[model samples]
Target: MNDQPILLILMIAVGLYTFNLWREDCKNAQAGKPSPSALPGATPASAKACIIAALGALVILIAETWGELRLGLSDQQSKITVLFGIYTLIAAFIEELIFRGFIVIENKGRALRWAGVAMASVLFAALHPFLWKWEDGVFAWTFSAKGWFSTAAVFASSLWFYTVRFASFNPHRSLLPCIVAHATKNMGVILIKGAQGFVVGLF
Candidate 1:
């Protein structure tokens, strides 16, 4: 689980995706395309907005479902925080770079926008898998389309839609909520593990 190969792959993917998205904009600006910045608003840059977003995120924290997904405590219980901590930190930044920074900001087309969302969903779920036993070799279903699709759906609804970038659909113009929402969600899970003893593992 601590292998560097996956991390290296992630790094390469992010760089390639960003270059693909922004290269056209770069070339176009050189030619004559209009320039428009597309960075999302993070917390603190907007005090009131940040507070409101944080509050909203707290609401999501209360509703988080990941804790329920855990069955019981294992040796991994104590280290749950470490695993999710890295997951939250790395995923928060990397996913943003891939989705909003590159995909949405670059294309802004409806179809491409959804494609970006779908791509992010798949990647995110692939990172987090359900419980596995050592003797099984590989969870046969893990490589199946149904398995991937279900996990992707869960990831999309929870992490992407219910948590991050709700504005991608409608009714939301602010990005602060997304950031705060993610933070609160991660923190809430941490609290649950401490208080009630729900544990998550990394394969």
Candidate 2:
């Protein structure tokens, strides 16, 4: 089954949503009520923070890739395309906005913030559909150890993303570092997929 069309449509929708988020941020900034904890933060992104967050995510990704390989799970084999790669990059920002920005409850204390991160991470991991898949209008449940491992990794990555946002390095709680970290993890996946000859074409 070719899912290219569906992917394209979803990408367009997601792009629009991202644009809207940016616009809202702009408006907030102009109103002198900048949402430092949200998208389009008023403060400039720190290059050092970007590097630290990206490296942190990259480390997690490497471990996940290794585990998948050891488990003989080639999930991306013959499944990726250039279009998908592009979508992944766009989706990285979108996901970060949703999971790390909007979903997170702000102005909370340290414990509450970490609790929110934990809850968001769980939801993020569950949304990845590793233990189940919807196909042909039917939702099927099929569990694999590899799938579980991947889900766990995603959960861990989400924690890292939230940590990056709340960490002292991101004093203003800017989303830039989170975005970079997410992108690094996603691009790493694309690179690994391509290296394994899983990326077929542009689609």
Per-model CA lDDT versus the true structure:
0.47, 0.80
Candidate 1, lDDT over the whole model: 0.47
| List of clashing residue pairs for candidate 1 | none
What candidate 1 gets wrong by more than 4 Å, as runs, is 1-45, 48-61, 64-87, 105-108, 131-154, 157-177, 199-203
**Residues 34-75, model 1: lDDT tens digits:** 247533422112354445555655654443344324422222
CA RMSD of each candidate after superposition: 8.3, 3.2
Q: Tell me the lDDT of candidate 2.
A: 0.80
Residue-level lDDT tens digits of model 2 in 60-145: 99888887888887663337677778787778888887787788877778788788889989999999878888887899986878
TM-score of every candidate relative to the true structure = 0.47, 0.85
What is the clash count for each candidate, in the order shown? 0, 0
- Location of the lowest summed lDDT over 10 successive residues in candidate 1: 67-76
- What are the clashing pairs of model 2? none
RMSD of candidate 1 to true structure, Å: 8.3
TM-score of 2: 0.85
Candidate 2 positional error at 31, Å? 12
Candidate of highest TM-score: 2
Residue 145 local lDDT, model 1: 37
